[model samples]
Structures are given as C-alpha cells and as structure tokens.
Target: MPHDVVIIGGGHNGLTAAAYLARAGLDVLLLERDDHLGGAAVSADAFEGVDARLSRYSYLVSLLPKRIIDDLGLDVRLVRRRYSSYTPDPVDPERGLLIDREAGAGPDSMGSLVAAFARVGAEGDADAWNDFYADTARLAETLFPTLTEPLPTRAEARALVGDDAVWASFIDEPLGRTIDARFTSDLVRGVVATDGLIGTFTDLDDPALDANRCFLYHVIGGGTGDWDVPIGGMGAVSGELTRAAREAGAELITGAEVLAVDPDGRVRYRLGEGEGEHEVTAGTLLSNVAPAVLDRLLAVGTADADARAASSAIAPRDQPPFSPDGPLDVPPVVRERLRQLAAPEGAQVKVNLLLTRLPRLRDASVAPEAAFAGTFHINELESQLSSAYATAARGGIPSPLPCEIYCHTLSDPSILSPELAASGAHTLTVFGLHVPHRLLERFSNDELRSQLQAAVLASLNSVLAEPIEQVIATDAAGRPCIETKTTLDLEEALRMPGGNIFHGPLSWPWAEDDASLASPAERWGVATRHPRILRCGSGAVRGGAVSGIGGHNAAMAVLEASVVA
Candidate 1:
C-alpha cells in the first residue's frame, strides 16, 4: 500500500513536515540526498581539529515562529544581541556608530544613541532611526501572525497594516528612495540597506522591487525584526527537529538520491553505494527541495516514462539518472510560471574564521567585545556599497569589499570546547555582499576565493587596530582556520540553485488580489499545478532564511485538504 505522504529532501523543513504529518497519524517517509539531515541549517566544526561548531552555511534566526517551537517542543534558546550593530566610519577609522539596544529606554540609552549618531556626523539620525524601525515594528506586528495561516489577500493585508503612507514607503515605492529620505548619514543608510541585499543581488532602486520584497522579509520577523543567535549553534535547532520527527514515528532515510518524481505521486530514487533504485507511491508528495530542483525531477520523470513506453530494455548502468536539458510536462500555466522565473543567482561570499581573540578596533571608545558582539560593518558606506554593486554587476570584484561580521561565541560560547572557551577563542562569520554568482564565468572558484578573502581581510583591517590575520587561530591541521564559500561553492554543497540561499527569490507573504484561493493548497500558498505535489521549502510563499514557515504551511495545507475531503 502507498504511504500517506512522502517528503523529498530531509532538510529542516522536511523534518518539520514529517513530524507534523506523522503526529497526525499519517504514514510519512522522508528522503535526504545527503547522509545527514538539516540542509544549510546544520552546524559543523568547519575547521578540522577545531572544537568550535560554527553555524556553517546559514546564520541567525528571526522569522521562525514561537508556535512552531512550542508545537515541536524544541529545546532551542535564542539569545537577543545587546548591541544591534556597530559601523566604523569609513572616512575616519577612529570614529564609529554603535547601536546599544541593551541600554533600554532610559535617558542614558537615548543619549547614547544620539551621541553615537553625532560621533559619525549624523546629528539628527538618531530620531530618524528610531522612527524608521518603529514603522517596521508596526508592520511586523501586523503581518507576522498570519504567516502560518491561510494566505491573506493583498487588499486584506493592506487594510490590516492600516497606514497608506507607511505602506507606500515599503510596498509601492523603491526602498532606496525611502532610505535616502529617512537617514542622513551615509554609514547609517548603508547599514539599513544591507538587509535588502543579503543573499539577493539587486539595486536598491530597481523598479522590479525585488529589493523591496527582500527588505520586507528582513524586518518582519517575529513582529520585532530582531535576528537572534541560536544557542549551541544551529545544529541544536535541526537536531531537535530530527528527534521530534523520529519520536513522532516518521521514517527518515538518508543517502537517498531521488532521481525522478511523477505528478501522480510516484517517486523513483537510489540509496547509498551498491544499492538498487527503489520506487514508492504516496497519497500526497511534499517537495522540500528548491522549485528548480522539483521541476528537474518532474522533467526527468516525464522523459523516463516516455523511454519506457518506446522500449522494454533496461537503461545502461553507467548512464546518469537525469539530464540537465528537458521541458516539464506539467500543466502549461505552471510550466510557464516556472520558465518565467528569473534564473536565480546568489550574490554574497560566506567566510567562517576561527579567531584567537576578538580584534581591537581603531575606535577606542568602544571595546572589542562590544563592537563584535553584534553586527560589525566594514567599508559599507552608502556610496561604497553602491560602487561595489556597480563594479560587481560588471563582473569585477568590489574594491574595499562591503561585509559584516558576527562573533557567535560572544553570545553563546557553548559551541566551543572548554579549552577553546578558556583560551579566548571566538568564531567570526563574515558575509560579503555584491559578489554575484556570474563572476564565476570570469574567474575560477580558487582564484575568486583567494581574491575575496584578501579583500575581506583588508576591509576588516581598515577599521581594526591590527591586521585580522594576526589573530586567526590555527586548526589541528596547523593551517589558518579560515574557510571561504563562494556562490558556486554553496550551489555544489547545498544543492541551492545559483547558490541562492532563499532557494529562490522571496515572495510577498500574502497573495495578489487576482490570485485564486479556491483549494486548500492554494489558500495555503503551497500548491503546485499537480495537485498531488506541494512545495515545502524556501520557494514557498513567505519561505526563506532558517525559518520553518514553508514546512508548517505545507503540512497545514495537506491536513486541510484531508479535512475538506
């Protein structure tokens, strides 16, 4: 007999769906291409012989809802950063702006923000900053709660927001214009703009408004827009999900490469080395892979079916399971929608470094601990960021790379060993923006990685009292514990198309006014043209980052369909 549901890809999202479906008495089977679960969210000791478990690919959490955590009973703890961000002045390395959120609403706290703004020659930006975030906080409160429910119409959501001017600033117009009008300081403007560009390659004023969509997701997390560090690294988050799924009676299989997926709920896959291909059917199919990947699977399955119809001969042993070129056999509307999607391209460099100690800054007023505790910005003046984007768009590496650093150990040292913790060792994660995947056409991964690493270090050193290389810790291999991953590297490792971390471009959480919401899947924003299959990954509406919103919504759709039937 067919299983009730078969989830393709055992990432955190798949695990979430499995846990939920299994608990509801559905026979669920989850397949993971990798040997382990937790696709990008898993933490690993990135450097050999190092005891520190860095968040590896994805970092920080904001969009994950409290309801999912409570329902899963996850033991995850998120640490709210005391310092929001610290940006060193590009013109004067001796000065910087530090947002001390921990200072609270006291006069001293307000004065500290005002004084920091003045230090960077942004005299009146303090109030502007507060007002700007307060607007986002209101937006968050209005939209965050609806993430798990059936999709809301654009009109309904706009009505809920209840502010035409605020809505126009975020939804109708370009975010660049809003940033330009709100903040005076170049450094402050750049800091605010970075959120829209993280993992997305787009100009701030792009008429397409991709940046606006990206910006909306960034600031609407948990209604507070606060990105928190997961205690014990990201692994703990996935580990809990895996445990929950297993305990809930979900059957999970690793080292399973799904070769093809039929719209009729048939799935063909191969297990680990020396294992034969296997077939399974389910009443419902939940795809936890990217939308591009799902399209490929369906296309390959269609081709395989055609071949079987033409001849009865078995395929050659050495032949690849699927070819890259093919057209999907799904309904025309769905095929056209998939084809029209702009080819996804990631535009950032992720570097994980093990440091012996937090480096001191040229701005002596703030301690190294305080500056690095939250986001530490480097060479990211608004003008510099725009210049970097222009140069990168022309397929050249940005001069004086714009990057941000987060020291995870400061927030939660449990990711480190007792010896490393005692030795003042810290983990620094750097996200370098404006380096799009298209650059791979100009240079090899090794060449670009070497150049990007050098640029990042140089940028970091410009604001530091000493060179960052001086404090880098050596791994057990006796080599510098620094790892750089370009967009292509991410594509190869995580199966993320074009290395796009969101799996695809982000979408507005609510549906367009013209969108059809006739079915349970449609209302839940998890529907595919093929009724049997549904998306449960970042490609789903409101899906992205480390949040399990996609998985939660997909499971809800499946459950709702059953009830309707």
Candidate 2:
C-alpha cells in the first residue's frame, strides 16, 4: 500500500512537515536527496572530529511562535539564551546602546536603546527610539501569532491589522524614509534603518522599501529580539531535529541520491552500495525542495493544477541594490552624479572570521561586563556600509571593505563544547553585499577573488587592534582558503522572478485568504502566489547563518495544514 505522505527533499521544512504528519498518525515518509536531513542546517567536518554548522546562515530565531516550540516540546532543544544584543553607534566609543540587559547596562533593553541613540546625537532620540521600538515590539507580537493563525479572510486581515499597531506600520511607509524623517542623527537613523536592509538586496531608497521592514518585523525574537545563534552552534538544532524525527519513526538517509521522480508516480532513487534503482510511491507527496524544485515534482502528474502552474510560473527575481536611481540618493549632495549599480555581478563578498577570542570594541571599557550583544560595525558608519553598495554599482569592490561582525560564541554557547565556549574563542561572520559581481570582470583569472579577499581582511585589520588573520590556523599544506564560500554574487545566483531574498521585493500582493478545510484559498490550500517554499537557512537563505526559521515555519505550516484537515 502507498504511504500516506511521501515527502521529498529533507530540508527543515520538509522534515518539519513530515514530523507533523507522522505525529498526526499519517504514515509519513520523508526522503532527502542527500543522505542527511536539515539540508542547509546540517553540520560539516571543518576540522578533525570538529563539526560546525555547514553554512551557518541565520543563527537566531525571532517571530517563531513560542507556542509551536511548546506544542512540539522544542524548548528542550532550542533554548532562548538571554545574551542576544547589538550596537549601531560607531562614534560613541561605547557600543551596547541598542539593547543591553546585563548589570548596569541600563534600566531596561529599550532604555539601553534610547541611551545608545542619544550617543549618536539624535535630537529627541531617546523618546523617539523608545517609541519606535515599542511600536516595533508590538508589531512583532501581533504578527507572530498571526503567522500560525489560520487563513485570514480579507475582513480578518483588515480587522487584525486595524487593532494591531505593529501590523499597521507596514501599510504606507518605506523603511528608509521613515527612519530619516524621524531621527535627527544619521547614526541613529542609519542604525535603525540598517536592520530593514539586512538579508534584503533592495536599495533602501527603493519604492517598495517597506516590504523588507515588514519581513524584518515578522522576524523579531519576542523580547529576545531578532537574529541569534544556538548556544553551541546551529548543529544543535539540526542534531536535535534529526534525533526527534528518528524517534518519531521517520527514516533519514544520507549519501543516497535520487535523480528524478516521474509523473507516473514512480519515485526512482540511486539506492545503496552496489545497488540498482529503488522506487517508492505514496498516496500523497510532500516536497521540501525550493518551490522551484517542488514545482517540478508536483508538476509530474499535475497533481493539482495551481501547484503545477505555480511551479512552472515561478520566476526568479533579483534583490535589487537598496538604492534606486536619482537625486537626493546617496549622501546630502552629488544630486547630478548619476549613480549606477554594480555592473553585471558586482564584487560583493562575505568574510567569515573564526576568532580565538571575542572581538574587542576599540574602546573595550564600554561593554566591560557583557558577553555578547550580537555585533557592531566600526571604523566607519552606516554610510560606509551604503558606500560599498554604491561603489560596487560601478563594478569595483570598495577599497576599504565594508563589514559587520557578530560574536556567535558569546551569544549562545550552549551547543558548543563547554570547553570551547569557556576558552573565550568565537567566530565572526561578515558579508560584503555592496561589492558587485561584475568587479570580477576586472580580472581574467581567480586573481579578482584573491584581491577582493585580501582587501576585506586588510580593511578589517585597520578597524580592529587585533586582526582575525593573525590566528587563522593554516592547513596541512600551510596554505589557507582565505575565504570560505567566502565570496558570492548573491544578486545573480539566487535572484529569481518569484522574489529573491534581496529586498524581498517579491512579497508584493499579500495573500490573506489561506485555504482551510472549510474553504480553501482558490486552488492552493496553504500555498501562496509567492514561492511558499522558503530558502531561508544558513548559507542557503541569505548568504549564511544557521537559524531554523525555514524549518520552523515549515513545521508551523504543516501544523496549519493539520488545523485545516
């Protein structure tokens, strides 16, 4: 007899759905093309017996409904540590302004944020900062539950957004404009607005700017704030989920390869050693591959017309640079200079720093007692970050590379060997989105990548008293891989029509009417016009970081499906 559900591509979402269906007693079988599950969430052997999050994409959870964790008893594996925070004040010499909760950091998290904004010299900054975040916090609260909330009717959405102040924020404002108009200080304005740009490739000044902000709002960590890593490493969550999936009677296979699944409902696989093709079939098929891949799968027999249409119809869109063309663009002046985007794949980069110790603030005295507030950008301000974006548009990597550093060790050390965590060593993850891929055009060979990597490291040294390069352990050959998957022209590679991660420009035309058992939304029950498939995981999602939202959301969606059934 066919299994009740056959899930393909064992990424978190796929596994998550399988786990739910199985727990629901639905005889679910999840198959990953690769041997292991947690596709992007899996760990790798970078050193002898040392495993770390392979791509370590987004290493924190926010906007993930706590209820799901409780319902699935995930709190046992995913613990929310109190040490997640960051600073945006470059000139203050004192970081930790954004949200510091340690002893004497401030009256509270918001208070610390207000104080941090004040240092940047924004007039009316404190109250303004408080009001801003209070509004942001509320939005996170309302939309978070609404995410798992059943499909909303047009009326339901209007009513929810109407009463929920946070939901109301996204309606009319572009993220960048809102920041500049309200805050007097560029540092504060840039700092607050900076988040609106993270993970997105949109030009901040773009017309559809507010969408990223809404995406940002959906990602908040509920007092824990957005963006964090597990205590030891992201592998903890992956390891835990793999364990749970197995305990629940789900089989996980690694190294087994599946080349294709024909529409005839025959699943073909490159089975075990010295084996032949293996096949499996089920009454229902669930796929965890990117919506693109999933489209190909469901399109097999045209199981459902809308799913097939969506799969074939999906277009990959690029995350446009945050800046659009025109005056009042970058900087206060240069109205007529006429800026351009990085020529056809600019030289953007990502530099991962494995630290022997926490990165010290140039003035270390400010955060004397704090372990990790996530990170702070230094040597320059937000303009510097934006400047890289601007420079890359011309097809050249900004000489002094722009960067942001986050201390993962201190943020959440539970997953790591206590020995490593206590040893006071950490890894820093930084990416250069502004660098254009076209700049690679400058070199005939790999020399362009080398030059870019060296430049980023050097710029980083200039900012830090102790540069990360000093302690980088060389391999057996005494040669180092300067950057590890270290450089990617993301705008080119992942950007597709259905909306690329850059700027999340594809999230337009919000679909409220989700399908329910009572009434399905058109042909799609829980799917969307946008690729309902999530690419959000370490490296796979926005460059890299190992947070489990992709998995979490998939699981929640599965639960929602249960609700519908």
Candidate 3:
C-alpha cells in the first residue's frame, strides 16, 4: 500500500512532520542519507580517545517552541543559565563586564543589566541598557507566538509592536545604526550585534537588512529570546523527536539515499553500498532537504528525461506526461526560480576542546566557573567585529579572530565520566564569526583547519593569565584533544550548501500587501508550486535555528488541505 506521506530527509524537521502526521493516523515514511537522525544538532565524540560527547555542529537551544514539545510529548529538558555572558576588555584585562540573573529573579528583571553596567564603571549605562532591551522585550512578546500560527501581515505585526519609533529602527533602518545610537560602550554594542551575525555573512549596514532578519529570529525565540542549554546534550532533543515519530508508527530508514523525486509522489532510492534501486509511492511528498537539492532531483527525474526524448524522432503528442510542456503539475518557471534561489555561505567556525582545567581569567575577582559557565566573549569589540567583517568581505582573515566560548560541562556534567568530572575536566566550544566560507576556499582544507585552530587559541590566550594550550587535555598518545570545523568541513560532512547553518538568508515571515495571492497556503509559507509537494525544512519562512516550526507548519498545511477537500 502507498504511504500517506514520504519525507525525503530525516533531520529534526522531517521527524517532526512524521510524528504529527502519523499521530493523525496517516502512514509516513522518512528517509535519511546519514546514519543518524539529527543533521547539525547531534552530539558526538569529536576528539579522538576523548570520552566526552560534545555538540559538534549546532549547539544551544532557543527557538524550539513549548507547544511543539507538549503536542509531541517530547522528553527534552532545557536549562536556563543564571549568568548570561561575560566580556573582558582587551585594554584593561583586570576589569570585565558580567551579566548574571539574580537569585529568584523573574524573567523580565533587568537586574543583570544594571549590575553588569555598574561593574564596568560606566555612568548612566544601566539606564541605557534597560531602555534598549525594553523595546526588544516587547517585540519578542508580541511577535514570537505568531510564528507558530499563520504569517501576519506587515501592518498587523507593526500594530502588535505598537511603537512606531521601535518599528522604524528595527524594520526600516540598519541594525548597526540602531546598536550604535542606543549603546555607548563599544563592548556592549558588540555583544548585541553578535546576535545579528550568527550564521549570517552580511555586514551590519547591509541595505537588504539580512543581518537584521537574523537578529530578529535570534532574539524572538521562546517569546523572551533567552538561549538555553539542553540537558544531557544536543542529542537528547533529536532522540526525543525520533522516539515520538517511532511511537506514532512512522517508518524511518537510515543510510538510504534518495535518488530522485517525482511530482506525483514517486520516490527512487538506493540502499547503502548497494547497486540495486528501489521505488516507493506516497499520497503526498514532504521534502526536508534544501530547495536547491530538491530542484536538482526533480529536474533529473523529469525535465532532463523529457529533453533527451524530445531530441529523438518522437511526436509531441506521444511524449510522456512528465515533459515540461506536457501536463506537469509544477510550471517550468517556478522550478527555475527554486533552482536559482541564492545559495548560502556560512561565516562561522566551530572549535571543540577538552580541557584538563578551566584557565584562570585576567580579572581575578570573577570565578572561572561563573565566567565560563555562559557565553564568554573574546576580542569582540564593536569596532573589532566591524573590522573583521570588512576584512573577510575583502577575502582576508582578520588578524585577531573574534569568537565566543561556552563551557557545557560547567552547566551539566552528565556528559563527562565520573572520573573526568571529579578531576575538573571540562569542555569548551568556541564559535568564531566573520570567517566566511569564501576565505577558506583560498587554502587547502588541512591548512585552513590548522590556521583556524591557532587563531582561536591565540585570541583566547590574549585575555587569560596562562595560555589555553597549557590546560588542554591529552589523549593516551599525548595528542591534544582539540577539534575544529570550518565552513568547508561542515559542507562536506552535512551536505549543507556553502555550509550555511540556516540553509539560506531568512526572509520576512509575512506576504506583502502587493503579493499576487492572499490564500492560507501563501500565508502559511510552506507550499511549493507542485500541488502534492511541500517544504518542511529551514528554507521555509520562520525556519532557522533548532526550531521545528517548518515541520509543524507543513503538517498543518497538509491537514488543512485534507479537511478542505
């Protein structure tokens, strides 16, 4: 019997759609090219001979909705950190800024801001900080819940935000201007601007406001925009989604590469290391792969064949129905648009390390555990960040790499063995920004990897009492247990085009007033021109980060169409 739906990728979004559809009594089949389910959210033993399970690719959780967790009955725990971040001044290493949530403080309390600004000896800084975040807090509360629902019109979203000045700064003008106008300290401005450039490769003043779109998604997730650490590891999130889909009776196949997909729900695939091919059919197809990949598969299975046969002495009327000029469901123009969608280039590098002991900070007053427990910003001044972006834009690596470090073991030690935990073993994950994919293209992969590792260590050591290398743990063979991944590395490992973590630059979540159509499918933002096919991945609107919004929206679209029919 044909399945109700066949999903082409088994990433978190695909699993999410499978779970929901299967729970609704529809037969679902999920195919994955990788042996594992999670795409970039997996936790693995990154270092050789190291027992620690580090979040290798994408780390941290913020965009995931509580409604999805409840609806799917997912067993995942996200822990909020008491401290938010700590940034030390490169000029005066003895003083630093630390933002910590006071004990028993409410989520909306501005105590952390007030405290951190006061510590830095900046006059009127607390008030400025409060004034700046107050607007974002309102925007988060107003706009976040609407993400799970249908996309709102621009007028409707602006009305909900209720402040014309706030809207003008964020929506009309560049985010860099807003950051510079609102904050006095360069370090504080840099901290806020970093949110805009995560996984996005544009400068702060880009006219398109690509950086602003990225910033909005980062700050609006979970209705308050606070990023939380997943307990156990990032794998726990994927593990729960896998269990939910399995329990709901969704069939999942691993190591099965999908060769092509037909608009009529026909799927051709091959098993691992096998020469034989197999076919499956479904009532509808939900693609979790990137749009470019889907376009290539469809062209190979349909248009290329039609062109091949047309060159022969075949009558037009006798041609197969799958021809471009025949009764194809999706038009050739739409297919071309999908194929020509802009490819994303990742601008961040990830480094994972196993430390024998946390390094002592230049500011001796702050405890190492307190500073490293949350995001530790290193050499990321606003001027420095802008300089790095300008340098990378010109195809040059910045002299001093600007990066942020997070110590996962400090928050949850369950990932480490009892012996390692007792021996003060910790894990440090650093994310370096402005190191675009194009820069790595100039050098061999091995050379670039070595250069990035050295740059990260040098940056971190500049603000520390001792070089970070002194505290790095060694394997049995005396090799340092350190691992680094660049944009090129991620592309080869995860099949991410250009190594873009978000799949591509994010677009506005709503249809414009001048849009050609006003239907729910357009408002929902998941439909393709093909009637029986849909997108359920990061390419969809409001899709990015670790959120399963794409999958949830796609499932809703299918169910709504079924009811209407």
TM-score of each: 0.95, 0.73, 0.92
Off by over 4 Å in 1: 309-324, 327-342
TM-score quality measure for candidate 3: 0.92
lDDT string for model 1 (8-27, tens) is 99888888899999999999
- Highest lDDT model number: 1
Ranking by TM-score: 1, 3, 2
Poorest 10 consecutive residues by lDDT, candidate 3: 316-325
Worst 10 residues of 1 by lDDT: 316-325
Please give, for residues 1-565, the per-residue lDDT of candidate 2 as tens digits: 7666566666655555555556667676676655566654544444333322323443444544455455455632444444433443544444434445352154575555555555555536767766776666655554445444443454565564455444445445666656666667656655565565554544566676543543454444543256544544555555666666666677666655555554434455666677776777665455444444433443332333334456799642322223223213466434322222311122335555444565555455455225244445543355665676677667666766655555555555553456655766555666544554345446633675576667767765664447657655443455442343323433322322112332222232224455332323221223423222223222122112232334444444544545777
lDDT of 3 at 496: 76
Predictions in order: lDDT: 0.90, 0.48, 0.83
- How many angstroms is residue 480 displaced in model 1 relative to the true structure, after the best TM-score fit? 0.1
lDDT of 2 at 526: 35
